[model samples]
Target: MEQMTATGVSPKEVRQRADDAGMSILRLDPLNTWSRVWLPDNMDDAYIATVDTRQDRVFALCAELGCRSISLNATFPRGSMSIEAIIEDYAKICAASAFDLDCSLEFIPLWGGRPLAMAWQIVQGAGASNGGLVFDTRHFVRGKSDLADLRTIPGDKIHCVQLNDGPLVLPDGVTTKDDRYDRKFPGDRQFPNVEIVRILSETGGLNQVGAEVFSPMLKDMSAKHVDFARLSGRGAQDSHGNVRKDLFFTRTGSHRPLRFGDGTIHPCLWS
Candidate 1:
């Protein structure tokens, strides 16, 4: 989110581009809902500013674009906030929004939402009708979560799905920071990308599949946009079973490496 805003592109420009290209914004990001209620005692004023700015601007932009889905992950590290406090904060945010949008909690293994189970717990406790999960393949695998557990979740509660592949083994002495920038394209490694797509299909309620590739290598390429679209299409075709690969190309919000029908691409979605 910090870097996203630093792209020097205005929200109004993004809005106009999406409108011009006939794209529909389906989600917003890391809205810093926590800033609305509380933050860890250790966070500094800069962190507060980043949180508030991302939230306020994204919220207003979503309203302008009619994007009703917001994706949130942990702003700080795990144990920075208690489960009870997080749920309470989420409930407050949801209530304050007057249920205008659907919100999903994305679990990142090394981040605050360290595992899938804990994220599910927060959603269950919050008990907000519009509350749900944003399942990302990298997070799911990194957290060492069971794919079978996904069956337990009501498909209707799955607000979004992201697909990506990573190395079969993490690099020695690697941190989450290292893991993030070193991702491989889908099926370029050992991730069960096809199975995940099939499972989400069976689970139902899928509106689109997000192709998220957060590679620093890709960022340096002059033709990275073209690569993202080509890889997204290849990945989707390789992964899609009975599901149509075209479903993955539909307009959405706040997902990475998102390719539009007219060839515009959203590079990365980081917060």
Candidate 2:
């Protein structure tokens, strides 16, 4: 079993650990949540000046620091920021920067039970398909996405796959999204387990499955002791096995997932 540890380490340190562990450090996931929280999505010249100024600084800093890709987990500004504006801004950033956008990961409120693919379309529809998706397991499952959605996707369309877990029971009022991407490691409140891994392997083409966890909890537990390396190792092994199991089941007739109106496939969620 290979292990990658970036405990209390800078990007350089973490990247080194991944390399030493024989793991290819793929996404340099960054937090854009600061934008939605810091400034209004749309702004006049003065506001644009201030925000763009900061944006340029961020690009420069990330490049200088050796961080490559920036993850799009940004929320709306302080109160109510427009999703359209935020997405456009994300696109704009990608356009100006040297960052390699394999594809853009759209941050969304749970649409039904997972991040909205329709919202993802917003990125593609808006011409931001630098590639495909940087899908997150929790966000996808929480959006209530089924495995069938994979059928329509072309093989090379999937960009990156982020691996993490959460609980089935959601927090109060949010029957859909967990609103806690910033939280840490395996066993989240609503992270899809075995099935989540499978969907990516099957539909997403399994380009780059990574352990991109973000939790305040990691501060207390050093890399040497963090969750004792559970999710990335044994947990991943089991999850991968389950994915294979699903494929095995697919060979049978009755166990097949249901079909959408357009004949697109989706899980036959019988809950």
In the range 83-184, model 1's lDDT, one tens digit per residue, is: 888788777666656438887888877667767777888888989988888888898888887777776777777787776777656879986656876776
Highest-scoring model, lDDT: 1
RMSD of 2: 10.4
Q: Against the true structure, what is every candidate's RMSD? A: 6.8, 10.4
Off by over 4 Å in 1: 1-10, 33-56, 220-271
The digit string of per-residue lDDT tens for model 2 on 195-263 reads 555555565355544455655555665654433343323332233322222331111122122122233
Q: Where is the poorest 10-residue window by lDDT in model 1? A: 234-243
Q: Candidate 2, which segments miss by more than 4 Å at Cα?
A: 1-25, 31-53, 77-87, 99-103, 106-114, 129-131, 144-151, 154-157, 171-191, 212-271
lDDT of 2: 0.46
Per-candidate total of colliding backbone pairs: 2, 20
After superposition on all CA atoms, how large is the RMSD of candidate 1? 6.8
Q: What TM-score do all the candidates reach, one by one?
A: 0.74, 0.54
lDDT of 2 at 225: 48
